[model samples]
Target: MTRAKLFSGILISICFGLFLSACSNGESESKDTKKEEVRTATDAMGEVTIPANAERILAPNMEDSLLALGITPPAQWAIGTTVHNYLQPQLKDVPTIEWDLPLEQTINAKPDIIIFGSPGSIQNGKYEEYKKIAPTYVFKEEESADWRKQLQVMGEIAGKEKEAKAVLEDYDAKTKEQAAELKTAIGDETAAILWVIGKQYYLFENSRFAANVLYTDLGVTQPEMIKALPKAEAAWNPISLEALSDLDADHIFLASLPNEPGLASLKASSVWKGLPAVKAGKIYEMEDPSNWTSNGPIANNITMDQIVSVITKK
Candidate 1:
């Protein structure tokens, strides 16, 4: 071979080697980028540290909050069979440990943690029992007030506190903006929020679920009839549909209760057609049950959007 040709061949070999090396380096960097980070956060119970990436998460309550943070657990414990229908689509596939959790089933799963609301469930001695199986957390179910706080707390337990904070902050800002828009759309209109559960109709005051958003956050006025009702004893109180006339407001938010007897009775009542809101078609029927009672991060957004839609939709 010619001397020049030999030198050229050597140069080509060196270039090929460098190209392979660059490709290998790029592959390594891609793998590193895909690696999951070990996240940590603190809650009221104590400091929760999820080692590396938590592969097997078990959530008992606050499924909506977990769904909001884009985390889906392998197993979850539902408040009841009916509650599962309220969860987001991603969470609907997870297996539930039944309404009242069995101690043995929880221990057998060997979950990293167990999250639950309803202080009674925690205080009833189940919390201690479950802690033996995993780190158990009890979050409050204050429909409007404690949802964000609880989401942060649960996020820490699931090793996703930063994500939780971001989700909650965005939800809060959007809720504030939507509330302002709703107030402007319904200016000076008195509104009342009510649910027809079983055979009774319940009007929510400041303390009930979603009431704080209407009464305190959006600054919407309430009718004197509803205002005169005693403060909700426990999130909601049952009222007779016979008293519908007493609940007269410029606008009425009738929570969707599919096939609920109270709803049928109200529709059938002779006085119902005469009510101002019903006659004027000012009643807004809540199609999404999640918006009525959920306190999760996504629920806040849903509620805000629904309120704005009902108030502004022509």
Candidate 2:
């Protein structure tokens, strides 16, 4: 073979090798880009890097905020057979997940991100275990308490900040309109909320659950009985029927589960029957107490509608 021909053949081999090296490097760079598609977010547990485009989200009790932001989670929060009935219209098809979020069930759900309602919700020191399945974000106690703020934080986590802001703005406008209507109907009459579950009775303090929507947002006057009580330490605080005899509410929003024995017991009690709201026929019965007992954007909105509808009934 001629030397020049042999040199040309060697040159062709070198060019082919370089071509392969460039393609390999390009492929590696593409993979790295895909791997880096995440953002560092500060949760209650501190900085956590989560997927920028998380698709399969699992926020148990905060489903209302998720739904408000137009996101559907893989599972709804439930305790055995109990689930938030008011939210079932939107989340009926979703599977039920334990309130504490069991490991095997979470793994089966295949969540890309798991946003917990509060640090307390991350029980049994299983935060690390959940991290193995997907990124986890936890809300602080105070942050979890305020549903509006919960909505905003979840929005930031889900990359829907604008949607969160818009939701609040629209909700503010809605409350403003409804507050005016409520003022016209009730006219400074004090209102209180009574939640009956089974044989237990719980009362709402001024800022707990949907009571915040009633007295704070919608301008419903808080009864002296409710105002005298301390701010609620938990979602539900039991108040005895005897203590409730002192209630000076002109209107009482009675929230109870269907077929609850507590309602019958309360109705039979002379103290309950003698209450001013009951005597005046101002006892507004809310058959579905799901929203009143829970807190979130969707929950609060439904609560507002429920209060307005009952107060303005012709």
Candidate 3:
């Protein structure tokens, strides 16, 4: 072959090789894109087949759990204009979703997976319909009040089990340190949480909200009045002043939402003044009720700080 002809032939071969290499890479990239692992997650309702790469997750009432995992979901739980207000700064831009989850609205959000805080949150037997829209998981009712179990399930759904475990381990370490400091400061002095809404009064049980941080995580002792009560329900149970006076706790953390009826009158009552915590001037009125009301990882941490600061200062 002539030199020029040989050179042209070599150029064509080079171009053809380049084209084949491109095709091979395209195929490999496409295969990698198609790789999606599936996982089986069991909850109170049943087992759900979920994608390991699920994005656009909707945890509704479990926004606290998702926040704990460092994931801001597409939507958080809403009741009209209210939600977990303590999480507002982190969730400010995220949209609020309804508890009822109107079919049209839920479909519009295009969630890849939906998680409920508890089975009771699945109103009108909408679990099957929700499954049609996306993989749905409903936790047991008990998990609603537990931050640890809530985060574990959230990590499982997000395929971030390692991240979740790390978050929990960190929280445990901090809780232990705080608990030790609190034990040293308090020295067996007991505490109690009281909430007044409308005309009714409530004594927070050991397991709910910030009380959990005080009693369970921090090992703070609950007054005999609190320990003797029947196991508390998920919601705050009501009690009368006569019953409340039985609590001789050294410290009282009184929580009340803004403008809640009868609170002013209750505070003015002689019965309230006669309580041991009040007489000793150990009553701490909470300025922001969210610390005690919103039960989540973040809230618990804040609650721990608040408890330690107030108790140690006094």
- Candidate No. with top lDDT: 2
Give me the displacement of residue 75 in model 2, in angstroms.
0.9
Residue pairs in candidate 2 whose N, alpha carbon or C atoms collide under 3 angstroms: none
TM-score of each: 0.76, 0.90, 0.88
Q: lDDT values of the candidates?
A: 0.70, 0.90, 0.83
Q: What is the C-alpha local distance difference test score of candidate 2? A: 0.90
Worst ten-residue run, lDDT, model 1? 36-45
Writing each residue's lDDT as its tens digit, candidate 3 over 161-271 gives 998899889889999999999999988899998888788888887777788888989999888888888776755568887777687899999888768776787788888
Say which prediction, candidate 1 or candidate 2, comes out ahead on TM-score.
2
- Clash count per candidate: 0, 0, 0
User: What TM-score does model 2 achieve against the real structure?
Assistant: 0.90
Per-residue lDDT of candidate 2, residues 119-163 (tens digit): 888889999999999998888877877888888888888899999
Give residue 253's lDDT in candidate 2 (0 to 100): 91
> Residue 287's C-alpha lDDT in candidate 2?
94
Question: What is the C-alpha RMSD, rounded to one decimal, of candidate 1?
Answer: 6.9
Give, for candidate 3, the lowest lDDT window spanning 10 residues.
32-41
